[model samples]
Target: MLPLLPLPHLNREFDYLVPAEFDEAAAVGVRVRVRFAGRLVDGFIVGRVAASDHPGKLGYLERVVSAERVLTPEIVDLVAAVAHRYAGTRADVLRLAVPPRHAKVEAEPVVDPPKIAAPEVDLDAWASYTHGAAFLDAVAAGRNPRAAWQVLPGEDWPARIAELAGTCAASGRSALVVVPDQRDLDRVAAACEAVNGTDSVVALSAGLGPAKRYRRWLSALRREVSIVVGTRSAVFAPVRNLGLIVLWDDGDDGYAEPRSPYPHAREIALLRAHGIGCSAVLAGHARTAEAEALVDAGWAHDLLAPRAVVRERQPHVVALADSDHALARDPGARAARLPAIAFDAARNALKNGLGVLVQVPRGGYVPSLACGKCRNPARCRRCNGPLALPSAPGADGAGTPTCRWCGIADANHRCTVCGSRTLRAVVIGAHRTAEELGRAFPGVPVHTSGGATVLDSVASGASLVISTVGAEPSTPGGYGAALLLDGWALLGRADLRAAEETLRRWMTAGALVRAGADGGRVVVVAESEIPTVQALVRWDPVGHARAQLDERIEVGFPPAVHVAAVDGSSAAIAALVEEAALPDGVEILGPVDLPEGQRHPAGGGSGRDDGFDGDVQRLLLRVSRGSGAALARALADAQAVRSARKNTESVRVQVDPIRIG
Candidate 1:
């Protein structure tokens, strides 16, 4: 029996005796309540054995949770593999894999799958990319073919993904497509339903309350739906005869789970594909370094359009730093937030009765501020945290500066440097940008999409849409032009994937504009010489990803080497390192104190709050690619040791974390 316990030492399966009364109901993969350590706990029957390996006598299961089998044999193996890869407990992975039991839904009779004819395959859609049609054909032929697809700018990506699903379903196999957000899920699910019939596809997401989520999950579990499209959590959906797994925009931070184990959706999809011998497609407008690594390793082929086709589909991208000529054209181009070129692009789009999209890096009114005199970053005196103006100024044109990290407002503030009291916006946000654009272009309707109020789509008429990254709204006929403002805000982040992330967001917003051949334009407020901006201008995501992978290899970062972040009390971190049998060539980076905002409150347990007197230190463990599995095993064993000793200090071990500074 696999006990539903997240403790590291008890991560393994346990032996249990089955009572005669529940013999028939206690089949493999069925949920059951078992007596573990003097307490009744939930678990699943993973296997049946006639002989006991344990020297001690086993206790009988208390009762069967339900006769319906929720866990599948395939899922059991998949979850185990995921746990091992992530240095996490199987119970932790299983929590993400299986939804909480809904007795009412479980008791409901299983609905029979509908008999719907698969829609005809649209080869024309795949014809744009080399080998794209062949990839679909292989899926239809029941053969696994992996590819990292770079989607064209003007392509109907959802429809293409739907076509792939339809082809797979036509071959009598299931397909699982995982997107990053509800918006993408809705679009892809709608397209899948249109191609494979409503009954054949089920959309899954956390936004759906418990009952609805379990209902949809049950549908897939019973094989009533051949296509499952959902957000990150749906990667573990138990679809039968899985033929294909597709992950869209794998670089999006939404794909990273914030909980324990912190598994990425892309890695999960790849693992599932490998285990099931199924086809895999990593599709996105901007490619990730991890995806590029797959291509470089010859594990997957690149599906890309020709250069000519790409040029025709993408917008005419321009960067303000492209030339000194730009500075001559507009003397204040380098300093002005919205220079003459941006104004001209917006004016032309508005004159043509087309919508305009303004992409901002931040979301609030003023997410960051600085001393107006010395240009020093403004900080809170109480907590020494960054200060910001979250809303517009008062009637007297004065605004209270509040600490972003700690909710304290500093009415009487002074700059540590130059002793200045006046403040200026270091980073502008979507709301403030909207207000400014409204004034810049009088009578032109301006809308903001970010924070609590995000619009899914806007009318394709003459108007301005100001949105923060990842929250840009779509229009019916596509926007006429796009303005990517404040490039430094995204590019200057203290992150390894800053450039890649910035490019992905830029490409996503830029792709919503009309084709450049038809007058679509994208203006980026960044240096022209920067590789990321140049990649966007040249419409070369593939090359950019390849370059990024090469850089990572040179620097020995992720995708080239395996890295784990261990954060906890200094003693706990040191103890873990000393306990673990670290593989040879493992490089230990630090045991440095965590940033002030990231430090945990005072605690003394090995759970989420594990730390020392509210102080947390982080250490990075790096190993060669071939030693990744060893590193994971070593970390898991160390964690198990701590759990066994009842260590009061909790430590967080995250493998291949999304960000490492």
Candidate 2:
């Protein structure tokens, strides 16, 4: 029995003895029910000890939650470390480690997978993966212990994923692969089913019917098959003998588990693998700075195709500048930020017999409006409602506009910043862009992407399709030319990782362009070529990330320096930050207010701000690299002090947030 004399004020872990009957059940990595404070609570079976110092009064394990060991030794220890750093509960972290109960399998036995040869594949993915078989062989064998494989894009991605699943099956270990969205998950699921007909391969998504999803989850745990593929939450899947973990587009926000103790899929997968010593891969078309950092730090290896093996030929991308001093300007393209060169490119592509893809800003008709002179979005003085073009036709055939936030009419309203009656569109949404495209190409069939109507539309071959970044259609022969409009909005996002996010979005959309249109052209709308543009220009993401990392190190960012975020009311956040322990290495930034109208629900608070509930905001705490773990330890200490308050308030601890400000 554990010693209960020194009662920890905190509801923390207590060491206890294993009852004789439950001795076998008390082994490490198992789950157990425990009696605590006159209530039954769940606790992880961290260990089974021979003896304990506490008296006979010490409580016994109520029951084993599961007959099978849910956590590996590595995960148990990793969770402990995580708990210490983030001041998180072991139970909460365990919830992340174990996939949902429905996703857990129990009865079925794993079966041997059939042998498969190196694929005689066809894919023109850009990553210099020209030497196809060699890359496939390396990935199949799990040759690299630290890193997983990234298949060069093309039709072979699906085939390669199945092949990897087969290898996991052969190893007698279950596998899990994560993608950015449900659509990709469906594609992967279909591909896996074609190769392995059993229930072993299933996709877990809340969008699917509860019963059906639960069935798939159970099948995976039972080793009904040996692999599970899905979005973020799939990382928690409790597959047995996990041999491999794969994350596609690790950089995408979709992988960030946005909940209590928000755990990212990549970090979770890495932790799980470290716990079990399993092999894994961090793969994507273009690597992010974080991924590149991993490769550079020797934490993961880069599995790439030869320059000739993959999609070496790219769309002829041109960077267009649109200042007052442009040599040529197209009258039709003057609306929005469409440069004449981009319009000319699209015109040529259509005339030359290839379809063109026009990328726009927002999906709605009028996302925002502004004064033509001041460039300020027209908003109601009483409320911050954005004035936008209404769906209904205007009185005289022109569309009427209204404010979405406050439902205020803007049909006769003039610009607030400038007194001019004539208002110009500050941000041309997807609908506006489609309208412009329709007007420009009168005879061409103009399809729009984004929002409800467009996202639901089935993919059809079109000559001119206008779409938002993610909603770009997957056209046959691809678009002859792709134009990324409204470069300012993308580059001007208020988020800290704006540049990184913009680049990723652009690259993902750009990948859809056909390789042969006007020699395959992609026109970027930018003044000067930024780093992201340069990376796209040279297709050197690896180098791009490396450079970014070097800059981060020089200027203290994650993977270089340690940082923690304390989010709450102004007083609460400030109190915690002040009380936080510092071993002379950590630094703090910003009790600063969050970006206007952008604070997270947990991120904001009302500090009696002029009698209105306003944001409490967040502060960034930075620590020296040497004391990275110590910084986390400090935050835990601070959290303890704040928890003892009579006035209960929420204080959040995040170890490494994806978004850095």
Candidate 3:
């Protein structure tokens, strides 16, 4: 029986004796209860043998949880392969593969799937690219081909992907699509419905309730759908006769798993294709270093539209630097403030009876606050979190300060640097931008889209729509003008992919503007000479990513070398490193101690940090591509030893963590 427990020491199947009374119910792929470690635990029946290989007495199957075989042989093998690749236990992979079983749904009769018919579509978008038609033809013929696509903005990518899926389905095969978020899934699902009917595609995401998600999962497992569209976790969807796999926006942080082993969705997609001999497509607006490496290695085709079509489809871009001589005389061109150029562009767009788009760096009423007088960052007195101003002022004649990190209200925040009592915004948010724009254009309708209130599309009427990055909505006729504000907040990030990510965000917002022929204009509020700004003005994301890739390869960082991040107590980390059998030429960075106050929960701001924990140390392991598998195996072995030795301290291991800094 494959033990359901995730203990590192028991990472494989164990022998179990089937009792005579339960002979009829004992079968492979069914859930069974067994005696493990002196306690009753659940396990999956993986295999059966007539003779026992061990001289020791085998544990008896305590009871059968279910007679239905939930796991397929293909899924079992895929789970094992994933566990091996990520240096994780098989049970951990299974946890991600299968959802909790719902008894009521399992008891229901399996009805015949509804009829699904394919629809005709215009393949002009694919034909516009150099080798796009050939790639689609290969997919239709069931030839396993790989492509790396740089999807142009406003390109109906969903419809294109659905056409590809339909082609594969017509050839008697299935497809799996893994995107970054639910918004992308909605778009993909709708497009797939247009091609392969509503019942042909099944959508899976964490947003669904337990019962609903499991029901959809079961439908996919039962081979009731030809295509599966979902977020990160759906990379492991068990599709029969899988032909094509699509990984969209691998550069997005949402593709990285935050749990143990921390496998990436891109890696999983590659693994699935390799293991099943299926065709795969890695697509995004901007190329990632990893995807570039694949193209360099001659494993995937570089898919893109012709230069003439690309230039025609893109809007004209302008870069407004902070050091412009005109800005010195203009009092409002501060780092966190808008400039006259932006104001003029908005006014012009509104006068033209077209919508204007303003992209802020963040959300909330005030995401980052500072002292009004000294311009020093404000912090909460209780938790040392960055302080922010609430939507309104308090009764004490000052704005109420709140912690953006811990959500603690600090009405009496005093800046430590300059001893100032008044608060001010260091970074303007979507709401504040909307408030300012509303007043700037009196009687003009101002709309805000961010966080939970993000809109999918907006009308192209004469108005202003303020949004944060990744939340910019589509307009009916496209916005006449766009303002990318607080560029430093994005470009100045202390991350390796800062420049690349900043350019991607800017291009995403710029793409929403109408074409140059339609009088579309985009004003980026950043340094004009910066490479990112230059790339934006030239509309060259592919070149920017290539430069970024060259820099990384020169420095022996990611894409160029395999990296793993380990964080834990100093002793635990030391033990893990000492026991690891890293290959030759493997480099180890510092085991630097991180600031306790800066260490919030893993994902984002959850609560207050009292700094009670002594200190957390982190180490980075870098090895060449040839030694990556060796390093992962050594880490897994070391973890197994630690588990066997009963080490108390817990260490977190993440392979290719999204933010290396």
Candidate 4:
């Protein structure tokens, strides 16, 4: 029996007796219960042997959990491969592959799939893109191809994705399209419905009820859907005769799984394509450094558009520091939250009966609170938590400071460094921006969108819409003007991807503004010379990503080299690193302690600058790309040895972590 237990010591299968009553249900892939460790536990039946292999008598299975053959052989192999590659346990990967079984859903009726023929469109529709037709034709002819696409602005990307999916379906092959989230999936699903019928595609997501999710999963397994569109987990959808896989907006953090092994959606999609010998397309508005690495390694072709065409389609972006020279003489321009140019643009847009969009860094009133005198961040004395102002204004029109981690009020607290009781907002949020804009533009309506009450789109009107990054809503005719605030908060992050991620976020919101020829303007309040700001102004995300990749290669950072992170107690991490026999060209860095504090998305880590914790430390291992497999095996062996010895120390191994910090 294939035991479900994931303990490192009991990873392999064992022999078990099948009673006569349960013989009919003892099929491969069926879950069964057996007596293990003096109690009943679930296990899968992988194979039936003619005779017992063990020398001694074996124990009988407690009972058959279900008769459904849910674990397919192909999926089992994929799970095993992922576990080995990440130095993780097979059972952990299996948990991500299959969800809890719902017996009642097994009897539900399958919906009949809609029948619709693929539609033919003009190849000129891909005019802005380079070699677009070649990629599509290759997929249509069932030629296994791979590409990394840098999508241009103002392009009908969803329609193009649908065209590709329809081409595969017309060739008698199934396709999978994985986007970042449900909203993006909805957009692609609509485009697919226009090309193929609504019934030809099915969506799989964990957001649905257990019964509904299971029903959709079963449909895909039964080959009832020709096209599947979903978020990360859909990479494993059992599409019969799979021929193509597409990953959209690969740079979005939503594509990164937070669970054990932490397999990225893009990597999983790449693995599926390579294993099944199918076409794969990785497309994003602002490509990531990792994608550029694939192109450098000759694993995928570079798909790009000409600079002239891109500039023409992009909005006229200007940095305040470059456009307003006289303001620098005022001595206060460096400290001004909103520059004069940005304020003027918003005022003019309102006067013309046009909408204005303001993109803030944080979501609430004040995500970071600091002392007014010393500029040191305020913290809770009880738990050492970073203090934040209440999301809403207080009864007296003042802000109340509260610990973000421990949820304790500290309105009367004083700064330990400078003994100042007055607190100021170090990083402003959407609510505060709305309050300021409402007062600045009197009689104009001010709408806010962020958190759980985010709006999809706003109607055309002479108003101001304040939203945080990634929460900016669409306008009917596009916003007449946009103001990108708090550029320092995004650029000052200590993480490696801070600049790249900031550019991506800025471009995503900037793309919503009307073109410059149509009287639309974008004003970024930041230093003009910064690489990220310059990239946004010139609309050159691909160039910036290429430069970033080159830097990483020179410094032996990730993508150029394979990296793994081990986190736990300092002793445990150090022990694991020393015990593992890493391959040549592999090096270890750091046993540094991670700050224990409440982490905010926009701002940097929250805590005292001098605070230190010695309990938990993180260690990173780097190896050449070719020696990655050897490193994985060595780490796994080390873990096995430790487990066998019943070591009290616990360590968590993660390959290709999203953030090294």
Return the number of clashes found in candidate 1.
1
* Residue 635, candidate 4: alpha-carbon lDDT: 87
Off by over 4 Å in 4: 15-25, 47-63, 111-116, 120-122, 323-333, 396-398, 597-614
Instruction: Write the residue-wise lDDT of candidate 1 on 71-183 in tens digits.
Output: 99899999988888989999889888999998988878889976656677777878888888788778888999999999999788999999898888888988999999988
Q: What TM-scores do the predictions have?
A: 0.97, 0.84, 0.94, 0.92
Predicted candidate 2 versus true structure: per-residue lDDT over 47-109, tens digit per residue: 665666656666677776666666666566666665665555555566555554432334444
Model 3 regions lying over 4 Å from their true place: 20-25, 113-119, 321-336, 394-398, 595-613
RMSD of each: 2.3, 4.9, 2.9, 3.7
Give the 10-residue window scoring lowest on summed lDDT in candidate 1.
Answer: 600-609
Give lDDT for model 2. 0.65
Report how far off residue 397 is in candidate 1 (Å). 8.0
> What is the overall TM-score of model 2 with all chains considered together?
0.84
> What is the Å distance of residue 453 in model 2 from its true position?
4.4
**lDDT (0-100) at residue 32 of candidate 4?**
88
Over 1-661, each residue of candidate 3 has an lDDT whose tens digit, in order, gives: 8988866877877898899987878888888889888999877988889987789988799998877778778778888877777778888788778888888877766656545444465668788788988998898888999989988766777888888888888778888989998888998999998889888899999999988898888787777888899999999887788999998888887777666566788988898888889999998777777888888889888998878878888887777754567567665665436787788878988999999999999987677888889887787777787887757565775556778667787766777898878776777788877887888899898888889898888877998999999898888878999999989999998889899888878887887898877888898888788998988887887788788889999998888888877777788889999988877888899788766632433343322211224678778899998888887888888888888888757776666666675
Model 2 / residue 226 / CA error / Å: 1.6
